[model samples]
Target: MGAAWETSRRTVLRGGVALAALAATAGTAFAKPAGRRLPFLLDMVQNNPGEPLFSSRFNDPATLKSYGYDGQVINEFIPPQTAITFDSFDQRIFPAGSEGRAWVEAAAKKIDAHIARAHAAGIAAYIFTDIIVLPKRLVELYGEQILDSKGRISFDRPLTQQIHRLMLSEICARFPGLDGIVVRTGETYVQNVPFHTGNNPITNGAASHLTLLGILRDEMCVRANKRVFYRTWSTGSDKLTSDPDFYRQVTDQVETHEKLVFSIKHTEKDFWRTIPFNRTIGVGKHRQIIEVECQREYEGKGAFPNYVIDGVVNGFEEFRTPSRTGPIGLAEVVDNPIIAGIWTWSRGGGWRGPYLQNELWCDLNTWVIARWTRDTSLGEEGAFTEYATTRLGLRGEQVRRFRRLALLSAAAVLRGHYSVVHPMGRLMWTRDQFLGGSDKDLTSDYAAIVAKGRVEPVLAEKALAARMWDEIVALSGTIPLRDHADRTYLRVSARYGQSWHRVVHHGWEVMLRGYAGDQNGRYDKAAMRYHLARYDAEWQRWQRLAKTEPSCATLYQPYSFGPKGPDGLYNADPDHGIKPATDHYRKLLSS
Candidate 1:
C-alpha cells in the first residue's frame, strides 16, 4: 500500500486551511454551552438502511453538510464477511499481497478523492475496521492452524496475527488522508457464523484481543499522525457487568494509549429500549464518544417514526457531573471527565436496512442530535417543535399532533410490545441475538397449552397485540401525509402491524393443544380455520402492497441479509415468517 500522492504545494496549502478551520471551531467544539473547551467529536457513520450505496446524493458534499456530521465513516468499505474476495467496485484494504496491490491502489485513489471532498466540507473521513475474524481465504492460504476445531480464532498461531498487522498497517499507509479507524470486535457479521460468535483473539480473553488490536491500531495511527477509535462493544467473552469497577479495570488497561479513543453505545446493550446507561462512561480516563443509532432498524424497521428524544437526552444527563449549577451541558460538568465527542449511527446496523423511508424522520432526528449535542440546554420538546415547524413545515396544531403521534408510537413499541415480550423472545424484532428458544419454542409451547383449554396469559398477549395494532392504524389515519411514498409507508405499516398481531394470534391458537395436554380430546375446528384464513390473507396483502409500493418490502421488513422470504412477505420470525405457521399446520393436520 502507498500514499496516493506526494506532498505538493496545493496539499500543503490545503493542510494549512484544514488546520485553520480546526482552530476556528476549537472554542465551540470545546465549550459546547456548558463551557469547558475540550474537543467535541461528532462522528456519523453512513449506514442508512435502504439507502442506495454510492449514489450521487449520498456522496455529495452538500448532503453531508446538511446532516451536520463532523466526520463520516464509510461503512462496508472492507466487506466484513468476504474481505478476501475481489469485487471490482467494493473498496478493500486487505489481502495486501501483489494479488491485491493494483486493486487496492485503484481503490486508494477513489478513497483519496472522497477524503478530499469530506475535508473540503470540514468533515473528517474514516474507514470502518471490520476485521471480525480471518476470512476463509486467509485461513486457506495460510493453513487451518489459524483457527481451532470450533472455528475460534487461535491466537497461539502467528500467521493470522501477522496478516492482521499487515492489513491494519497497509490500510493506514494507503489511506493517509483518513482521520482514523473505528474498530468493532463484537459484531463481525460474517455470514453463516450464527451472527454473534464474537470473533477476536481467543487465547487470553476478549479484553486481551481488544487491547492488542487497539495497541496495534494506535501504533499505526501515531506513526501516521491519525487517530484510532476502539469501541467498547463487549463482543465475545468481554461481557461487562453493570459494576463500574469491571469497566474501570478494562478501561485502565486500554485508555492509557494517547491516540486511541473509546467508543461505547449510550446503553450497555445494542441500541435497544429500557437498557440502562453504560456506566463505563463514568470510568474511562481517555477521550470517549457515545454511539446513538438514529434509525430504529429493528424496533419498527423505519416503517413509522420511533421517537427517542427522551432516550438520547437521558443518556447525556446520566454522564453529567452532579451539583452543576447554571446551564450545564456534558462539556461543562463531568465527574470522570474526558469525554470528547458523540458518534451517531444514521443507518446500517441490525437485520434491516435504512430507518426512514420518507427521510423526514431520519433528517429530523439526525439534526436534533447534532444541534442538541452542541447546546444541552435545548429542551427536547422545544427541539421537536422547532424541527416540526422549520424542517417539516408543520404549523402549531400540526406540530403538537405530530409530536403526540411520535410519542405514542414510541410508547407502543418500547413499553407496550417490547416490555411484555419475554427477554429471550424477540419475535424477529431484534438483530442483536440469535433466534432461539424464546423465539421458536414459545409458540409451540403455547399451542400445546391451548389444546387442553384456553390459557389466560396467551389470550392476554393476543389482546395486547390487537390493541397496539388498532391504535397504530387509528393514529396513522389521523396524520396527514401528502407525499405518496410517505402515505404508502403508513398504509404498509398499518397492514404490517395488523399482520403482526394476526401472526401472534394464530401462533397462540396453534400452541393451544400443547398446553391442554390430556384434556385436548376435542379439537377446536373454528379457531383453526380462522387462524389459517387470517394468515393467508396477510401474506396476500403483502404481495399486493409490494406491487403498489416497490420499496415497501425493504422499508417494512428489511433484514440484515436482505428482505427475508419471498417478496418480503414472510412473518416476523426467522427462516421465513411462514415456517411457524406451516409447522403449526402440520401439527393440526396430524391431530
Candidate 2:
C-alpha cells in the first residue's frame, strides 16, 4: 500500500495538447504582439510545502516575482472534500449557519493575510476547488433533495445550488482582495466513487451541472468583483475522441456570463503532445486561458526539457482568429477577447516533484513559457541564454554547453522514446500502448515501422543526448568553480533522464524478446535475463542517486517505476514487482 496507494492515480501528461501544424508551418518567428500579451498564471499547491502542490518557497514574494507570473491558482486549501472533514473549514462547507459565520469570519482573516502577501508580491491569488460530488456531510443533509429519482446527484436542486452559492459567496465576500475562484467540473478524485463511470449520478451529465455551478460562481464573483474561471477539462460523460458536442454544449452554456472565463488546455483533449489545437479554443464569447503544463508529465515530467514552444506560439495565433470560432459567431472574436491568460503548472500535476532547490531545468522551462506567453516573439535560444546568465550565473561556454545538453535531453526523449506510433502518447508507464500490436507482433515487424524511416532520427537524438550527458557529467568537478551548484542539478537530472531512457528502452527489448520467444515456441532466456538485469541495474544505479540527491528522491518518486512486486508493468512499483519478473524470466529460460 506504500507506493501502491498512488497506483490508482493516473500519471497524466497534459491531456489533449495539440501541436498545431500552423505552428510548424507558420515559421518560428516569434509572435508579433497581437493586442495584449496573455497574462501568466501559476498553479500552486495548497496547504504550504507538501507533496503534489505547494512548497513553502511558493509563498515567498521574491519567489513569486521571480517567475514573472501575474496570478496563482492556489489549489485545494478549501477543497470540498477536505473542507467537509473539518468543522473549522466552515466557510467552505456551510457558511450560512451561525457556527459557519463565526468560522467564515475567522478564516477570512487568515485568508486575507495570504492574499495580502500575494498582492504584495504583485500576484493575484485564486482559490482552486474541485467538487465532483457533494461533500459526504452535504449529501447526508440534503441527499434526498440533491439526489434525483435514480439516486443520482443533481446540481439543479435548490439545496445543491444554495450550497454552491453560499460557499463561493462567503469566500469572495470575505477575501475581496483575492482574485477569483477556478474550478473543474470533470475529474475529481473523491474517495472510491468513480468518475466517468457513465451511470455515476454525480459525474454523469456533468456538463449541465458544471453550467449550473459556473453560473452560480459567476453571479457571486460579480457581486464580489472577482473572476470565475471554469475549466473545460472534461465532462465525465464523453471522451474527447468523439465528444465535441459535450464540450460545445458545456462551453456554450457557461460562456454567456461576462465575468466568467473558460480555462482550457491548448488542445481539446487532455494534456499530450502531437494532438492538434482543440477546435473549442476560439469558440464561445467567453475568454479562455491556454493551460500549459511546463512540468510536463508525459515527456519526462520536468526531468528533461519537453518544450511546447510551438503549442504556446500557436495558442497566441489561434486565439486571434475566427476560423475555429464556436457557435457564438465570428464577430465575437474581434469584439471580445479570446485568451485571458497562460495558466501554467510549474510543479505538481504528476508524481514528479518535491524538487531540489536548484531545479534549474524546470525553472528554465517555466521561465520560457512565462516569458513566451508575454511576448511570443521571444527567441527560445535568447531566452535560455538570458536565464542561464542571470538566474544561474552561467556565462559564455558554460551557458552554451548547458543549452546544448538541455536541448539534446529533450530530443532524446521526444525523438528516441516518446511514442511515434501514438504521436505524443504518454510514455510514462505504458510507453507505446497504442501501438497496433503486442510487443512480439510489433517486434516481428518492427522493420515495417522502421522502414517508414523514422527510427534513424530517434537513434541519432538518443546518441546526441547520451554524448552530451556524458560530456556534461564529466565536467561536474570543474563546473562547480564557476557554474556553482547548478552543475550538480544538471548532472543529477541528466543521469536521471539517461537512466529512465535506458529502463524504457531495455524494458521494450525484454518484451520483444519474450513475445518473440512465445511466437517461436522457444525462450531466449539469456537475452531475456540480460535485458532484465540491465534494466534492474540501471534502475538501481539511479536509486543510488536518489539516496544521495535529495531532490532526486523527493522530486522523482521511484515508486512509479523501480524494483516492484508481481504485476504486469502497468505503473506498478517496480521494486516490489521486479523480483517476480526476474524469477519468471529465469524459469522461462530453463523451460
Candidate 3:
C-alpha cells in the first residue's frame, strides 16, 4: 500500500501540467465575465509548523491558476514586526537597537523573495495579520500609553493608532509588488512569535471596529493604492464584527472604495455545519468574498471523506431555519454584484491533528469550489464527476459509485458527529479536529437526550450513519480503479471512517444507557457495563488501526477527569460531575 501510494503521490505532483492543459482546453466553459473573474484565494498554512506538501503543490503559479485561484494568502510566515525594515518607524518609538532588529532585516529579504516568486507566477500575493499586533519591545516600552487598564491593546489610544499607521506605511513601502493586506481582528496568536504580542483592538463596539477599519481603509486602500480585505471574523469577543446589523453599521460609516473588500466566512458563525449563511456577505456597500475551508477543521480534517462541495454550492440543508425561507449557499450569492470572489483555505484550520498523509479529499473540494466559482451554472455533482474522471482516472460506472460514496460520506459525518435532534445553536459531542471518545460533552448531551425521552431516535440516527459508513467501506473496496494507489487510499480512508464511527456509536451507547439508567432509577449496571466494555475494546482497536495505517487519525483519549486534562471538552465539565458515571463503569470493570 505504501509503495502504491508513493507512485500515486508522484502522479499528483506531475498533475500541474495536466491541470494547466485542462484549464486551457475548457477555458470558455468556465470563463469569467469580461474585465472580471471572481478572484479565488487559497491559504496553504495547514498548521503552525505548516504543511510542506501543501505549499509545494499550491504555491506554484500553474497549480493556483489551474485551480482557479487569482491570488495566494500568506500569514504567520513572518511576524508583522519582521515583515519590513525597522528604520521605517520613528527611532523614539521603535528604537534603533530593538531586540529583533537583525531578525527583521533578514525577514524583509525573505518576504521580498516570497512576493517576487508570487508575482513571477502571475499570481497576486496578499499578507495576513492580526490587527493591533506589535513588537514585544514596543508593547513593553509603551504598555501604559498604548494598552488599556485591562492590559489589552486599545485602538482608542492615539499612540496605538500612530504605531498602526507607521506599520501599514512601512509594509506598503517595503513590498511594492504585494497585491494587498488581509487583516483579521477576531483572534490573535503570539505563541510562535517570541518578539510579538497582540490583542483584538475592536473591543469597545461597532464604533471601535469602525475606528480600526477607518485607519486600515485610509492607509492601505486610499493613500497606498492597495486592496484591503477586512475579515469580519471574531472569537465572539466583539459581536459587531459578525452581527449583520452591526456589520452594516460599522461598514456604512466608512467611505467605500474599490480597493476595500469585506471577507466573510460562509457560515454566520465559525465554520461549522448547521449554521445560517452569513447574512453579512452581501450586506453593506462593499464588495465581499466568501471564505470556504476545503478541509473542514471540525469535520474530520480530511481524515475521511467529509465532502463539502454539495453544502458549499447548493447550501447546507442543516442550515435551514423557520424564519429564513431556505439555506443560502454560495451559488445563491455568487451572482450578487457585490460578491467579488471566493477564498479557500486549502488546508489548515482549528488546532492540530488529524493531519493528513493524502490530499485527495481536500483536492476534490478545492477543485470543485474553484471551478464552480468561475462558472456559477456548474452543478456540484458535475464538478465531482469531472474530478473523478480527469484526476482520479475513473471511468463509467466507477465514477457514479465514487460520487455516491463521496456524497454519502457527507451524510455520515452530519449524522455521526452532529446532533440533528437538537437545534443548531446547541453544542455537539465533538468540535474542531477531534472526534468524540471519552468527551464529557458526549455524555452530557446524551444525558440531555435521555431526559427528553429522545434517546431511542438519536441512537437510531447514529446507527443509520454507522450503516452508511459500512456502505462506504464496501463501496471503497469494490471500486476497481486503474491507479492502484487511488484505490488503496479510498479503501484505507473508508475503513478509517467506519472504525471511527463504530467507536463513536459504542461510546454513545454506553453514555446513553448509563444516563438513562440514572434518570429512570433502573440503573441497568450490567447493560451499562457491557457497553462500557465495548467502548474500551473498540477504542483499543482504533488506536491499533491508527498505528497500522499512518493515514488514519488518532482518537481523543481520556487520561483524567479534571479541568487540567488534555481533552478540552472533558476538562470543561463542571466539578467533574461525570465522575460518578465513570466510577461506576470502573467498578464494573473490576468485577
Residues 226-319, model 1: lDDT tens digits = 7777776755456543345766666666535566777877766666665556666645566777777766555654544566654465333222
What TM-score, to 2 decimals, does candidate 3 have?
A: 0.86
Judged by TM-score relative to the true structure, which candidate is superior, 2 or 3? 3
**Once model 1 is optimally superposed onto the true structure by TM-score, how far is the C-alpha of residue 524 displaced, in angstroms?**
5.9
Question: Cα lDDT of model 2 overall?
Answer: 0.51
What is each predicted model's overall lDDT from 0 to 1?
0.52, 0.51, 0.68
Off by over 4 Å in 1: 1-61, 77-99, 132-167, 189-199, 210-214, 240-243, 255-258, 315-336, 352-357, 415-417, 421-458, 480-495, 498-502, 505-532, 555-579, 582-591
List model 2 lDDT by residue over 418-508, tens digit each.
Answer: 4434242233432211111222224333343344543323333333334434444554433442454556666676676666666555454
CA-RMSD of model 1: 14.9
Clashing pairs in 3: none
Candidates arranged by lDDT, highest first: 3, 1, 2
User: What is the C-alpha lDDT profile of model 3 across 225-339, one tens digit per residue?
Assistant: 9988888888776765457788877888888899998888898787788777787877878888888888776677777888887777766646534456633676666666888
Clash counts for all predictions: 27, 29, 0
RMSD of each: 14.9, 9.4, 9.2
